[model samples]
Target: MRADRLVSLVLLLRRQGRMSAAALARELEVSTRTVLRDIEALSAAGVPVYAERGRYGGFALLPGFQTELTGLNHDEALALLIAGSRRGAQAFGLGSALASAMLKVVDALPESHRDTAAGAAQRLLIDPDTDLLSRRTAAEDVPDAIVAEVRRAVFAGHKLRIHYAAVDQPPKWRTVDPIGLVTVRDQGYLLATRSGDDRTYRLSRILAAEELDEPAQRPDRVDLGQAWQERSTRFRTGGDQVAVLVRLHPSRRDELVATALTVLAEDADADGRLRMELTFQDSRHAEWALWQLSTSAEALAPQWLRTTLHNRAAAIATRYEDSP
Candidate 1:
């Protein structure tokens, strides 16, 4: 931890140009004496650090000097800076750690490359919370305390007790063995298990979490990727899947197919509409997808779906008919 603190201390001066001993102590959460000692250690290690006396004067790096982080070229450094710009770390409650690491990265670069790297990173944006369409993503409201506890339990190989609200279920308390944390499409999930059964809890849905004293009852060395894949496969196969046949306009064919779980068959119908056999998660899923296309697509098979659409159209028509 002291080594990390020293590195951070150096990086802080590099980033801020200079800081008073008190400022350094506050930033690193240590006493001013510790900061002065770390400054001595940095100087002894051949860092180009120096001090200036009097008001508005403090410790700073020598002009144009850098403590080159081992083996990273400018481009590789640029890539990492870009990766850090993504606020995804905030979801896992690692924001402060990510910030400190990024400071060290910039400071570690060769002086000739540091400014260029920071400037270049500024030009490249990653996941700006909103898009060109002006649709902003809802921020996940995770309590800092809950995320900290959950993250610790995952890494420490411990069980966790959580107040959870499962999909379509009321909130309830449960015990789980946390395997890992995952963020997808800006949403976070805690990959866990309950009594040896695979369970995935959306981090956003975690109402409260308590790291348990008992050790985890799960595998010590879990390959999270493989476990997630297995769970995903089972979930997909066990869900309600349906095959849909539809007549779609030529221009909308691609869009419809893109939304379906699979496009089983495709052909031109007698009237030139593109006929597509598609797979959806279920009937409700099929209805939602096709309804979005409106007149550009018409569901043909599964008479029940056809009747549902017909009834919807009839109801709309009746509304207007009754108005007059």
Candidate 2:
């Protein structure tokens, strides 16, 4: 920890030119005495650290001192390059530059490590597949430029004029003040405020986005994290509400009861099967539960659910019967 602090102190001085002991101590979570000692240790190791006295007093590194990156071995260097290349491409748009830098780093490695690195690289492929975009329909081919602009506006707290495609409705232009972006599985979403109401728009549905010249402001009481959490909870709970009783093997009973659908009651049968009463939000959810229980459990409640299950089974059997 002390060594880490000393290294951080040196880097801080290099970046900021000078820093007082109190400032360094606060950043490093140490005392002024500890910072002073670290400065002395750095100076002893020929770091050229100097301290000035008085109100403007602080530690500074001598001019022309260079920091070297000699600690990383070949494998470590290759790993860092790969990680950096992936991040740079995804986050910072430094695609080809990152790849070129990685090539140079890999070429500089020794023959043995280079061979190992090549094998590792081949085995650990990080392909950002472009094929998924091909599956999108004409309606979904919203420009990447528009998406990027919306993302920037959201981060910058700027208002946006967007041409959006609403479900079962014609495309219309709307002005929204973007709060943040939400990523749901493969799709990106914008959570925004429009006319005092919160709205979520799919990225693919956005036809165009124009950033307004006015600076953006957030509502004092609005919390994006809390809003997303509540939205998720409501979505999960809004499905069909039905009580279901199922008998599961004793071994799997505990796991079954621990699912999101609450277990209202439980009983152990003489034959070692555990009967559980559970509630499901919808028929689809109930069907999913029954599918999971196939061969291992039995539904014991709501005759309609059992009938639906039987009908589904008959349809599935008909499909197989019609198969070659």
Candidate 3:
């Protein structure tokens, strides 16, 4: 690990010239003391690393010092550079590793193609934190320690015990044979099995985790993609899935689709509004989603849903009717 850190330290200085020890520590996720020690080690190894003295002083490599690396063609190099720009690595605690690898990629490209490839990659952006509408995307918060433990169990093929807080349920301890970890839409999930039954736990809801010494009772080789697809199919069809038919203003059509699990059918009404059949995880989910649209959407087919919304709106109106 120290060797990897030492190489990362060198590559970081190589890509970004003249970085202070404090700045280096932040980038490397270490302490300034560790950075100082690494610098001493680098210098002792005959690398011409020097420190400048001033308000903007920092460590830098001597001019013309370059590490020899294999070359990549223009498009190939740009593809890697752009992919490395994505923030997914942070979800798995590989953010620093990804940064270090990208630096090596840039350094490896032939000098003539290096600048152009890096420049072209900068022009394309993928998955910004905020959309064009200015609403910030929600990111799940999973502690570093929890993710580290979970990853260890998954890779080591050991059973894991986690204190998980399932939705609308009190927190509880669970032991499961580890399968694999997956992230979707920035939410992390642990796909495991308890007593031979498939189980999926949200990483954010995991309050604590412990990797057991016992080996996991799972297949030596497994198809994770197929497992996930099977689980998802079960989830989409298993619950008290509620299908609702609704008429929504054309402008709010996207909003309705975003909250629904499936859009079974859709068409434009005579008055230009959209008539659609959608399904949600449950009636509660359906009502909550329709409630958000308020006057812009109306539940047409499900008489129960329409009555519930009507009663809810009437209660609110009654409460405010006597207000000043």
Candidate 4:
């Protein structure tokens, strides 16, 4: 651990030029005496580190000295830079760390490949703000402390207490045995359980979190990919799932199937329209999704939803009738 701290101290000085002992101590999360000792260790180990005893200076590396810690080749360096540019790192509160590491990686690259790699990274874009459809999914920012806490619990197999804001509900504290952490579409989730029931909490919705002293009740080794898939299947299958039978123009079948949660069955109607048996999250969700297609989609079953849409359309028609 001390060796790691010494390397960090040297790197900090290399990156920051000169920092006061107190500043180095604060940055390394250690006492000023420990910083002085680490500086001494670096010097003893042939590192070109020295301290200046003036008001403005404390510790720094000799000029022209740089750490050759990166062993990445050209393609590898470009790949890392491309990954670093993604917005998803903010979900787990590693955006700053990733940026810092990326800078160091760039600095460590050889002069010959550095410009080419950096330029290539600039030309590539990951998760751009403006899409052709104008749909931008913002990355979530979990408080660093809360994310760190949940992360520790997930890794160390500790029970976690979290103040979670579930959909349509107020934030409330719950103790859960964390199964695993999952990220989908730039959003993060804590796959957990309360009393053996499967639960998934959006990291964005977690107001606060603390790792309990109690160990989580979970398997010894987990296959995260399999666990995630199993949970997803269970989730998609077991809810207040609404079934709908709709007849739509055959040309629009792909669009409806793409948007539906599941397509239970399909048949060709008498007029050659596509009759689909599909499921939605609920009535409201079904209505909202169908309404987006306008006349392209026709929700035949669930008369309640049909009535609601009929009233909504009539209100719009009345406005148009009075306008002229």
Best by lDDT: 3
Mark the regions of model 2 whose C-alpha exceeds 4 Å error after superposition.
Answer: 1-143, 161-175, 184-187, 199-227, 238-243, 249-270, 277-281
Highest TM-score: give the candidate number. Answer: 3
Number of backbone collisions per candidate: 0, 4, 0, 0
* Candidate 2 lowest-lDDT run of ten: 88-97
> Each prediction's TM-score against the native?
0.68, 0.47, 0.81, 0.73
Model 2 clash pairs are 239-281, 240-281, 240-282, 241-281
Cα lDDT tens digits, model 4, 183-260, are 787789888878998788899999999999999998888888888888778776878888988889888888888777
Give candidate 4 regions above 4 Å deviation. 1-85, 318-324
| Candidate 3 C-alpha lDDT tens digits along 3-36 | 6677778877777788999999998889999999
Candidate 2, residues 233-255: lDDT per residue as tens digits? 66556655778888788877665
lDDT, residue 228, model 3: 91
Pitting candidate 1 against candidate 2, the one with the higher TM-score is 1
**Of candidates 2 and 1, the better by lDDT:** 1
Which residue runs does candidate 1 get wrong by more than 4 Å? 1-87, 282-284, 301-324
RMSD, every candidate, angstroms: 7.3, 17.7, 4.7, 7.4
In order, the Cα lDDT scores of the candidates are 0.81, 0.69, 0.84, 0.78
Winner on TM-score (2 vs 3): 3
Q: What value does the lDDT take at residue 44 in candidate 2? A: 88
